[model samples]
Target: MVTVQAKLIFEGSEDKQRVLDLMRRWSSCMRYAYKRLLEGHKRNELKKQLQGIFNLNSRYVDDAIMKAKSILTSCKERGENPKKVVFGGRQLFEKLQKRHINGKAYKKLQLKWQEKRKGNLYSRGDRSKKGNLNTRIEIDEDCTRLRINVGEREYVYARIQPGWKIKDGRYIDRNQLLEAISICGQPYSVQLKLKSGVVYAYFAIEEVFPQPAITRANGVIGIDTNAYPRHVAWVETDEHGQLLGYGRIPMPELESGSFEKKEYYRWQYAHMIVQMAKEKQKAIVIESLSIKDRGRREDFSGRRSRRIRHYFGYRSLLEKVKLLAKREGIEVIEVNPAYTSVIGMLKYAPQFMVSKDVASSYVIARRGLGLRDRIPHNYMMFLGRLDVNELEELKEYVRKVVKNTYVRKKQLREIGRVIKFLQSLESEAERLSVPLDGTSTGSRGKNHNLWQVLKVAVVTPLSPERVLRDLSVLKSLLVSGQVGKTYKGASSCFLGQGLWLSQIPPAGAGKA
Candidate 1:
């Protein structure tokens, strides 16, 4: 699979004229043959018949005419009738043949149509098109020079000023090309031009193979996508419930506050961390967020939420990790994130009242779920089970309470102000002798209307103190509006229920 790419360099003014002239002559001959065929002459017979008229020394022209004859013969043999035989097909055939013949010396010649036709026959209705193939022309490494054979009588070569150095260990080895095809193998080299005014060639050596599998590595890292400060918490676990290492990479803040930049930086950091983890021989685990949901819009009032969503490239990051891990021979697994955050917080930070605990738990939960079920239980089992339905139910309940509390708080504040205004008005009316009745009207610029105080109390009897304390523990959720006011009334009912069944006890306590 020797591949070659080239860009045109200087073709002397005279050489350009000669090339154009040859092209014109070839085109004219093809047109004449096509016209003869359309005028009721047999195309195959006519193409072969005209071969002798031109000097057969021009292999390019001969090859083109031969191809046209082949196409006409193919169509006739297939028992299909074609409209008109055209010259375009011949012109293309000739150009490709010419390129192949010229590039054959460089071992970069790739001709798909050169082989005998197989399976299908050409039809008259098929459009004629030109072939685009890279014509390999080698330049000497010592000096930028190209080798070309012009006419049957002369061998011409041109040299460019100043040689360019190849990059790394890559070099154009004449011996390699001269060797047998099996020994030469595939061409895995790419040409690169550097800013230092030097051109370099890079080749992939066959020595690099997949790294030895790390069978005993029993740890995994979980990553969470964040907005303001993006970080991936690594909760290292062992065979037993012993914490190993916890690491995080804080994304650098963008000066412009562009979330897209933040996402890019986050991905870069994640990529680096993943590589580092692999070097340390740890498997990576990440969330498999739905692409469609990531882009879905919500009727949110905060501009920050919208900005973060719009700029967040979660799908891209996930895809990048998957691809990079595979190439590096490191396993990357996606686990359900239903309540990883909550579980992570419950298991790791029993005393710490931080929103990150939930996020951290989410990462841990995803990794824990990805582990093989047959693996012996240890810190992973303590991380909790991957019960999708239970996690979703808890998340939904938390979200509903948070939303309801937020709406109620706003309503209460507005209603309180309105009540104060009404009370002041009623007092003034009483002092001015205005009737305190709904139908009362007075002539001394006094009118009265009875107003009923609207009772907007929430029906649930919640313990305000407990709710407040829980709210403090969930500051991140509260600030982000992920959780609503703690329903104090609901807390007691939850205590007797299975609310904390999945919750893990503190690090030192027995598993609950």
Candidate 2:
């Protein structure tokens, strides 16, 4: 897919006015469509409503509904609240409330806000319609002519010409647009954006480019995206999943910087990763985490909410890498991210002597190669040695905290979740203890999340508070699997009344 931005040349001021009027009407229909769509109205139903409410043809009405539906879908993907969304900038809306301001400045701001509300138009291409039914473009001698259907038979023509865009003191040439539009009868979606009476056209055409000859059968490069101590940990693995090389792509720009700087660095880092994969003739592996599944803003508050919206651009970077990889003909693999960090920290970090993130990439790389992780004998024995009865005592200790502690409602809820999670872990542990005499696979879950059980089992001993974060602790359990006699009472940090008392390693571990 390739998109080019060009300036739409108008023959007269009347033509510009006509486009602006269409944009205003389109925006009005779009808002109505959004309202109806939110009320669970179907696209066909909303289309009928738009045609009756606004002065537009069938194509314009469908486009408005399509655009509105896309916006709603994106909001869902980003976990944004549709109800709290302000059409214009929220800052601009608040500025209108200020009385101590210049009249002209106030009017300019007002105009800008109104423009956002009613200055957008779009139309999807139709191959059967000889390109687009609305913004129809065709070759005209040396240049191309764009014919816009303004009314039920009336039309306006504009010449497609290359334009220059200045950004951060750099001028970007648009000559590629002319080259792209040189071919005729190709379907191209067009979006016209109005700014101070000027119409800028964005032409996007999607085409299936040939896949690169290089393939994933060679090897894989696994990437672990990190926020704090911002950097992307990457590992190059052989086709058999053995680690060959490793490095980190520094991304401090994500920690604190302007949106432009962040965007620039995102591409910079994405290009570097794509180049590495290309040079190694390997496929790229990354987590397939959904943006909407990350967390909702309503579930958190203050800095936590801000972090959900503003923290590391995981989705953005992931998308950038995918785009660049596609263009370079490098294969990109997406693996389930469940417990990759936990498995890495507990199993690979100490064994490989690397940071948690790098270890995570290693696990990811191996997963891409269809390699499965088995629980080490040490941790499995640890679980097998666990006195399942002691978990009940731990729950009792937590119930007392919820009843007597003065923590916030949210914290209490979190503690409740922890208790429930512990109960589930306890059930699994009892199963593990039952098969202490065999090395058969019946000790625990093959259907259940083996890594999740290990996560809870190992994390409880080491930072019991931040169990979910896996904050770089318990990374030494794999170094010397034969070590023993390490035990701590489940009090203090555990917040328990020393109820979780037992031998961490089973006394008869060798027997098992």
TM-score of each: 0.38, 0.70
- Which segments of model 1 are wrong by more than 4 Å? 1-139, 142-212, 239-242, 254-268, 289-306, 310-312, 318-329, 345-512
The sequence of per-residue lDDT tens digits that candidate 1 reaches over residues 209-273 is: 36535322556556666554544455544433245555565544532465555555645765686
User: What do the candidate models score in CA lDDT, each in turn?
Assistant: 0.40, 0.70
Give the per-residue lDDT digits (tens) of candidate 2, residues 1-512.
66777778889989878988988999989888887888899997777667777889988999898988888998899999876666766788888878886689999999888887888889998878756889876666577767888898999888877576532223566554545554666788888887776688888877554586656689899999876667899999988988898989887777777877777778788888888898899999999966332333344454653574475788888888888888778888899987788778778877777878899999999888888887776665555444546554544544554444332233434334434433554454464544321112432323345455555445543444443343434433443332323447523333233534333444234543
User: What would the TM-score be for candidate 2 when compared with the true structure?
Assistant: 0.70
- Model 2, position 108: C-alpha lDDT score: 90
Model 2, 75: alpha-carbon shift in Å? 9.2
For candidate 1, the TM-score is: 0.38
What are the clashing pairs of model 2? none
Clash tally for model 2: 0
Model 1: worst 10 consecutive residues (lDDT sum): 118-127
